[model samples]
Target: MAKQTAKTTKRSLAVINTIQKLGGATLDELTGELEIARSTIHLHLQTLLEEGYLTKEGAVYHIGLRFLNHGEYARSRKKAYTLAKQTVTELSDRIDEEVEFVVENDNRGILVHESFHPDSHFPSKERHISTAPSSAGIYYYLHSVATGKAILAELPDERVEAVLDDRGLPRQTAHTITDQDDFIRELEQIRDRGVAFADEEYVDGLREVGRRVTGPDGSVLGAIAIIGPKYRFTDERYTTELPEILIEYVDDLETEISDSYLDDYR
Candidate 1:
């Protein structure tokens, strides 16, 4: 009984995550994918349904909207995220490109907020750029994206090593830096330049420039990035112009966050 009780929580969470990944699943489908007993799966699904974490229609079980409440609550707890959203929106409008503010969590980067200009061209279907509000939950590998690498550059070498240990450098494109030594050198360059660039590293035809935002206490808050097509981000633009523009916005965002932090105590 103790063993069963101990395993119940982990198994139940796995069931929820699997259903979310599959969009929706039937009891038999979940049992097949999870390789758990049909009776046990049914028990877990029924409990989740009763707890308002899952909803069933006909024979299919889907993740419930209750998770949105938790997600919103988690986002609200980050004061910097609230300030960064405005910065992302403003930068997107100013540059007429897609802008995003992302934070590192558990060695992965999560999109806290994103904004797209009206003239922004959508990437091919193979890429995962989403203009919807739901895109806030999207996660990316730290070594593959400009914003993620910018955040990684701000972190200590030990913490960065830990992140690499937790999430290995997977090749997303031919340009991705998969070697540990090369990646470490790249971070060093980013630190020296105060900005990071991803030229077709995460996606085949996309390029991005990112700068890290830090709080008044010098802790890494997150990173903000501007993304566009490779053609638009030419040599001078990618290396100098866009980075200068991005750094300006990140500087303003850091100052705003610092001011807000001071205001809270006063």
Candidate 2:
């Protein structure tokens, strides 16, 4: 009985630490890392289960879904996403450009919403962005486009540094920024200004104009972007007057979303 109790206590500590630090740990990773007997680990997990601290799947353990339900509820109530749609779509039509909306999730910008060319095909610098589920979030590397850079510009340096350290920069195109120092400088420029651009940097014949969009709390909600071929984009709107134009549209989006929340309260 004494041996069982000590084993239980140690396993409990391991489970708690794993959940707290890594967010989730699969059984294989835990067992291999901890070098604990499966039966011993299972007993402590059963105790944590009874106490409502952790949950286990077939071979993995993670934070409970209860936390996720609450988080989703809060996200639904946020005015940021609710308010940005019309403006995003309108900006797409106004510029006849491919536009997208992103939010920071898991320390990377996720493109949650988008409005694109009639067929919805948008030319990305080195890679083409397809509206199909397979291509949307999973394709482009964060450093591969202006849209991604605009979102990255808003992150804390330490956090961005960690991401680069984790992924390193994979070369997609010759124009893609592969140098760490050069990329950091670009991020700095984006922070100082309110926008970032990919000037045929990630792909040949493609250009993008990107601007940061913010919520009332001033957190970067995401970015709204215009992307197209370098020839037409550089000649007409992008180099000419589109910066101010997109900025105005963003202002309209903020006001519109704020009104949405106000209407909901009323």
Candidate 3:
């Protein structure tokens, strides 16, 4: 019975993955990919379709809209998302740029929420806002982008080392710091300054400034960033003007999140 259950679970997962990879697939395509009997594949597809997990359109089967409902429900439950929903708009209006609220999920950075100013112009489809990195055409690297660095700065030295070991510092652009020692030193500087800056490291003609917003216990909850083109982000403002204001916004977010979310648990 246990073996039968395990086989069923594996078959279901393989069918879902194959459909996802092909975008939509006919029963023949699924049978060819899985090398399973046509009758068994039809039975599984019928089960999934009856459960509203898959939708059939003539000969092809596609993932159903039920997953979007699940995705939004999961997103709304995050403490970071709840807190950022109320404040990211104001931050975007104040900065006159795109504001991103990103969370550290495992070793990858996930953009949970984003607010854009009326004047903000997202240059490309690849550069627009999204939670999914693949859809957004953005790379997730803790050592490269400002939001990733801000979260990395709050982690202990050992945890940071573990991340480095697990995912080697791959270069995104010429300015990216690939050396482990240099990246460690950069984290130290961010810890001291309470802010992290990515100066054309992640992209050739873009810049970002970020700060970590932590809970009362100093655990990193998320990071907020102000992102824009390099030409608009002058060195003078980045070093002197922006950091102070960015830190103030981050501090306010931290206080609000701590009081509203973390205090309840305590």
Candidate 4:
């Protein structure tokens, strides 16, 4: 088969993303969003509709559920997803709080798995988000959220600098670290202790503890975190009890993944 041309691929992907963002849209809405002519949008829509990748109702177009199959297939290939599911559930039950398993992708963290008590309310449950500067102008300060800080701690200095250069250290809260030197010091502390803490730097009333998961060869897989209200996750518990438990869970997960899915590192 021939490879798709860049122009074709770009336009097609943009069209798909536009529909996804709008939830459902008419041809005119898509045309306006994409800045493409009506005829061009209609052509792509016709092709997607014919291929069952999109569906239409009353002149509005929406993404087809067929993408679920593709998403499931992609997720099934990640060993961490399955390994994280059980551990995240147990952590949630153990802490009676919200727990999340996140993986770094292109320097951003994606919430791949999550477990939370029914009564708990976690505002940061977005499926995807930047690990550092959170959406609401709230900086998860790579050193703030346990998961982001843990991963940052394990990375080499040059790589960490690159991430900072690309995404500046913006202050999200009064507690956020705006100075790179101060952030480096914080990362050094986390490395020595093998854990990270959010400390209400990301969200005023929220706190989180995170530990990084590694492969047998010490490749970073991701990080798992226990999150909740600051009132419950006190400074004492965060510095003491919580790190011990989160580290244990991360240890078990790392060992299992290293033994069973070593190929992931390659």
Ranked candidates, highest TM-score first? 1, 4, 3, 2
Candidate whose lDDT is highest = 1
Count of backbone clashes for each model? 0, 3, 0, 0
* Candidate 2 per-residue lDDT over residues 16-120, each given as its tens digit: 677655657776666666767877676766777776667777666776655546545654566676556566788888777767776666555566566766633
TM-scores, each model vs. reference = 0.93, 0.63, 0.79, 0.81
Worst 10 residues of 4 by lDDT: 130-139
- Segments in model 4 whose C-alpha atoms lie over 4 Å from true places: 1-5, 123-144, 170-174, 261-266
Over 2-84, each residue of candidate 3 has an lDDT whose tens digit, in order, gives 44468887888789879977989999999889978989889999998998889999999999877778767866886667777
- Record all residue pairs in model 3 with backbone atoms less than 3 Å apart, i.e. clashing: none
- What does candidate 1 score on TM? 0.93
**lDDT (Cα, tens digit) per residue for candidate 4, span 63-127:** 98777678667545777678877899988898788887776665656666777687556555342
Report lDDT per candidate.
Answer: 0.89, 0.70, 0.80, 0.77
User: Better model by TM-score, 3 or 4?
Assistant: 4
Model 2 misplacement above 4 A: 1-78, 119-127, 131-139, 260-266
Q: Looking at candidate 4, what is the lDDT of residue 58?
A: 92
Ranked by lDDT, top first: 1, 3, 4, 2
The numbered model that scores best in TM-score is 1
